[model samples]
Target: MRIGELAQRCGTTTRALRYYESLGLLTARRSANGQREYDESDLRLVAQIRSLTDIGFALEDTRPFVECLRTGHASGDACPASVAVYRRKLAELEEFIGRLTAARDRVRAQLDDAERRSRPCKR
Candidate 1:
């Protein structure tokens, strides 16, 4: 398939596909006429890239995992360094979630207090 078809199938823009290719996360073949050609494997790779990115993994971080997958590694976690990277990412995510939860609780309390103040006082 071409870039347009791949973009439509992935529910993304052509520019995004190009960006992924540039990041070395996706691979494409050059046609005889110089247009890009993609295969089913490329589609699956794009889906993996999207999922990892949605989960807060940066492209740089994802590259090693993707390489491992492509090289038929038994498991990314088997590599000690990869495990360390994942652990770091998980810790960062936990801290971010904690901060966001605290902010949400503070906002909820403020909203509740505002609502109570807005109610008419009982005689």
Candidate 2:
């Protein structure tokens, strides 16, 4: 298939495919006429990239999985590299949630203080 077919099948855009190529995450070959062409494997690769990026993973972060798929694995996450990315994403999400939790606590305290201050003074 061509870039357009691949993009439509993968639920992504041609511009995104080109960007993935630029990032070296995706690849294509040139047809006899010099137009970019792809195959079924390329379709799977783009799907893996889409799945990862849909859940907040950076485009770069998806490279390992794409490489894994290229290596004949059944699934992109079948390799150690993809596992490592999952670990890293978990750590990042944990830290982000921790920061948000702390901010929530502080906001709650401020709201409590304001509410107490607004109450009428009863001797």
Candidate 3:
């Protein structure tokens, strides 16, 4: 397939595809005409990349999965490297959520305190 077909099938932009190529996440071979050419397997790789990035995974975090796919794994997460990335990401998200919850509680307490202070005293 060509770059355009791959992008359209993978629901990404040609620019993004080019960017992936630049990042070494995706690769292509030059045709006799010098146009970029990709295989059907590239589509699966793009889908994996999109899935990870959509859920807040960093581009670098996607490297393991892409490598797994390139090595003919049935799924990107099939490799130990990919699984390790998943674990790290999960831990990071849990820590982030904990901090967010604490911040929310602090903000709520401040709002309640302000409301109490603003109340008018009755005789």
Largest lDDT belongs to which candidate? 3
Q: For candidate 1, give the lDDT of residue 56.
A: 85
Q: Provide the TM-score for each candidate, comma-separated.
A: 0.69, 0.95, 0.98
Off by over 4 Å in 2: none
Please report, in order, the local distance difference test score of every candidate based on alpha carbons: 0.81, 0.93, 0.96
Judged by TM-score relative to the true structure, which candidate is superior, 1 or 3? 3
| lDDT score, candidate 3 | 0.96
Q: Sort by TM-score, best first.
A: 3, 2, 1
Candidate 2: give the clashing pairs: none
Segments in model 3 whose C-alpha atoms lie over 4 Å from true places = none
Candidate 1 Cα errors over 4 Å, as ranges? 73-83, 101-123
Residue 32 lDDT, candidate 1, scale 0-100:
98
**Candidate 1's residue-wise lDDT over 1-123, tens digit each?**
999999999888899999988988888899999999998777766776677778888877777666665676655445655677788899998999999999999999999999999999999
Q: Candidate 3 has what TM-score? A: 0.98
lDDT of 2: 0.93
What lDDT score is found at residue 27 in candidate 1? 83
